[model samples]
Target: MTAGRSRARGVATAALLGALLSTTAGCGSSPSAESAETDGPKSTWEEPASYSYTLTSSTQVLAGTFRVAVRDGKVTEAVGADEDSRRQAHDLPGEVPTIGTLLQTLDRARSEGADTAEAGYAADGRPVRISLDWDKNSIDDEALYTISSFEPTPG
Candidate 1:
């Protein structure tokens, strides 16, 4: 029984690894701009709705979906990902400094040796950008990923 459980775990891990590999491989090949825009307008802020993007690297892969709402130049709602992804997103704001407070954070992270990073904002004014610096390296090793959505909440 113990051996069977171990095998099952190994299989699950392998599956995840395969998925990650596939995603990274896809990223390796530059995607055509036209292909990337299969749905919605080119600019997310044009309309009030949700947007999602999948980010993947050789080491890890993550999917982030954001629901943004703006009204009268004020941000009404900003929600990202599902429960698990939300947990990851929650750690983002606190870990990295805000764009307003420190604009150079992105550049600095890039210079260090980061693996993945991204920046985004709403058309109104509110901006939410999340960046990940793996191994504390420069942008060369980092991946810049971003998702900008727009939606207005009730007053």
Candidate 2:
């Protein structure tokens, strides 16, 4: 009787395990744009040689909103929209990044196995927001960028 009871309990546990696995199969969430970057068909959007956009950065080092202009793949101008942005624009102009630069940063973060690196794209496949946290356990190694009003300029 004891041997029979043990076999029955083992069978019951196996049945429960099988049922749970079957129920959870194919229940994963859909991949987001950031994860898709690592796989699947590439985005159709390409970075223009000249463009302008509004960038709102929230991070320890850069926290401000700025109107950024990129020409010939370089940041030709950056105007701060607020006091902090203006100060950062005037003092740390090198920190003001273009869309390509931001993309590169995100890529590097992903390569380095950052704790978090996610992005949201516009309908045209342009990145509208990028969130990075190099080390979730550590403080001050995070960056959040919001891009808006992007317009490609003609040469």
Candidate 3:
């Protein structure tokens, strides 16, 4: 009886230790992937009818800085800021997207349960950066956009 009781106590102690370790394993750990993602895109942000913003995009297809001008909810003009961008702009002018389009991209990524979808905003509720990675394990599936020099034109 004494030996049996000792074995039971040892098993109980081991179980307890396992439970405690499992419970505290996540303590003091960094934020999880879910928490690292920003709170999606800002819903309050409204794209102006006519606006121009510098877009620095790092993606598989469109990878360059572009000076985009939107008028009446359309990209009326897109000027490349560098040699690569100039070539891209001349070759693929239709690929240039507007701010609204970028927001939509973020929204779509989040809804589709992308591995990474984060957005940084400015003080006045403007998006400064949008990062997206559809699949964490896939290559050339990430897109980063930096928006700056935003000016709303009088329509």
lDDT of 1 by residue, 27-109 (tens): 74553432231211122323223222222211133234444344443333435547745654465433322223222544455
The per-residue C-alpha lDDT of model 1 at residue 19 equals 62
Error of 3 at 136 (Å): 0.4
TM-score of each: 0.32, 0.72, 0.74
Q: In model 1, what lDDT does residue 123 have?
A: 34
Greater lDDT among 1 and 2 belongs to 2
Candidate 3, TM-score vs. the true structure? Answer: 0.74
**By TM-score, is 1 or 2 better?**
2
Worst 10 residues of 1 by lDDT: 34-43
Tens-place lDDT per residue, model 3, 37-136, is 2455455678999999999976666778999999977899999999979998888888899998888888999999998787767656667777777887
Candidate 3 clashing pairs? none
Error of 3 at 91 (Å): 1.0
* Rank ordering of all candidates by TM-score, starting from the highest: 3, 2, 1
Could you give me the TM-score of model 2 versus the true structure? Answer: 0.72
